[model samples]
Target: MTIAVRTFSQLNEAASAIASDRDAAFFGGGTLIMRGINEGHAHISAIVRTTDAEFRAIRTAGSNFEIGAGATMSDVLANRELSFLHEAARAVGGPAIRNMATVGGNLFARSPYGDFTAALLALDARVAAAGSSGGRETPLADLLRDRERNGHGVISHVSVPRPAGGAEMRFVKVSRVKPKGVSVITIAAYLPLSGSRVQGARIAYGAMAPTPVRVAAVEQALEGKTLDASGVAQALAVATDGTSPASDPIASEWYRREVAPVHLKRLLLGQPA
Candidate 1:
């Protein structure tokens, strides 16, 4: 059953409802949850549905924008203010799925399906949430790093500082199909270039790790280097230095390692595969 709530105050009550029952969860579009339920997740008994007007708002008042957790993928794609995320959002499932999948649900996705989180990681976004303990803000990196410790609260929104206009930002989603389904390798890289020299870099790799993770080794290697063949090669060499991709039917650990650097290079240096 789904409990309809219109405000965060009411949402807290709904969240509490979960404790009263053995199995309960917050409903963000119900995409993954419905599948779990159909797959015989009899333990899940209640869902706290969030359709509040505030949750649906696309707030872009200043240089930074806050995306309500309930905002749909379609909302993100259509908003010119959030153009940086448009490519990432469009890279999600097809039109109908995009229309129904909520932004918050995407953040809490299990695996291979979290392309949007990769983009958010590169942008260094922050999350806003509320619970019985009250609301607070947490960096997306921190949440991803300690999800079990920090995810007890319900996410209300995400605060993303817009990337500099001159920074090169690219999202590469490699899947069995284009623009839909789970990605085999999803890379989001942001590099600020001062002429031919690399000023700074933030690279996030998805589906290639247990969680969508930032490659700090590659980032450190690229910063302050001249973007020549040698510098590019060096950075690429350490790109997957510490990553351990899961072996699965879609891709093997060896295959993801082989191709992760290729897509990373392509997204950053415009190298075509």
Candidate 2:
């Protein structure tokens, strides 16, 4: 069957087009959708594309960031203001894939592929999406939770607040292959420090569950604790809690569970893996 492609210059029009067509999918960078089409995953009969300038814009106010859904990984890398995220953006793939993979596409990527989403989760990002019902902003975690049901909506942009003063963020992606490969387990942590003690903490993992998620058990253990070995030990004790990693060609469930604490330890101590 031939696939129909629809292009719109307005986000609302694109949202309506996809929401009204049950078999239509939104085309971001085509990284996932094209692969599905080539592999004969035949649910999609049409694709909606957009060219609205706002759809590709990346803006900042004060220290907060608003990134368009259509912003490519390359775009993220090119912005000096987003340097903190350069490491995660570079992990998307090589230069070619970075040029074609959009932030919106990465949000819906399957396990081992949504490493960037893990980074966004650590930053406590919010996603803005529009559909036939109208537009709304939701936490990234909530959107990821219901992505399958809400995938038809057009994501306009994502909003992220910079880590506050005295706060530190770290991201680590462990893969079987070097430079660019799917994640074995990706860890991102945001720790707010009041002197030597950690206050609220956000820790997110990719390839640790069916989707990227936070290890609340570990976060709770680390509250009001220093980043010293003792605090790290407590975190390691419950590192695998709230996780259900899968066994795949890249790594086994046992292996992912085994190495999660090791990487989390390294991330906490600012050590190299």
Candidate 3:
């Protein structure tokens, strides 16, 4: 079906208007919109654009960094103040996609291969949205868990707390070479060490299950342990427990399951598992 598109100068007004329009939807950079339309996944009748909204600022508010939902991946990468998200944004699809894909769209779509989720989850991000219900903030993980919870509202901004406790954060994505391969598995680790023993460890893996799963078992194994070969193997084993993966055209479940833990161990401990 053909989708008629319209642009609005303000975000809240446009998003709220679309909520009642019945046939209208909000459009950001049109990167995902056009792709979905071409792939026959989206069949909307109209689009309300947020191009003109003053919703692309990246700044600090209170204790967190406020990231405009409309901000592009490139926008995040280019802003030195948002250095934490730079690697994740660079890991996204290629340059053109980085220039076009919006942070709000990536989080809202909840694609398993999305790089930002693992990063944001590690960062303990919070989402601020505005809609018919007024406005509120929710944990990013909870918002992602319930995509339909938000009405036709705009994710006005996201708040990410500054990294604490001298934690070392790492994000790893293993894909075949190119712009095409979906993630075999993605891992994000936040490790805080106290004199060679792990004081805290938070490890989250993506594309290894229906949704991103935090490897609490692995985290527990790594916590309070020195980063050694023995500890790494235990952590790797914990990371793969209770997981039931399925084969797809992109990758075999066996390959994903095997490679994921190996990558996780390497990323965290900096050696072969």
lDDT of 3 at 54: 50
TM-score for all models, in order of appearance: 0.90, 0.96, 0.89
lDDT comparing candidate 2 with the true structure = 0.89
What candidate 3 gets wrong by more than 4 Å, as runs, is 132-135, 148-152, 242-246, 271-273
Per residue, candidate 2 scores C-alpha lDDT tens digits across 153-198 of 7788888897798998889999988988889999989999999998
Question: For every model in order, what is the number of clashing pairs?
Answer: 0, 0, 0
* C-alpha RMSD values across all candidates: 2.8, 1.6, 2.5
Model 2 TM-score, all chains together: 0.96
Q: Which residue runs of candidate 1 sit more than 4 Å off their true CA positions? A: 1-10, 18-22, 131-135, 149-151
Worst 10 residues of 1 by lDDT: 1-10
Clash pairs detected, candidate 2? none
Residue 29 local lDDT, model 3:
70
In model 2, where is the ten-residue run with the lowest total lDDT? 129-138
**lDDT of model 3 at position 144:** 65
Which is the leading candidate under TM-score?
A: 2
Q: How far in Å is the alpha carbon of 260 misplaced in model 1?
A: 0.9
What is each predicted model's overall lDDT from 0 to 1?
A: 0.78, 0.89, 0.75
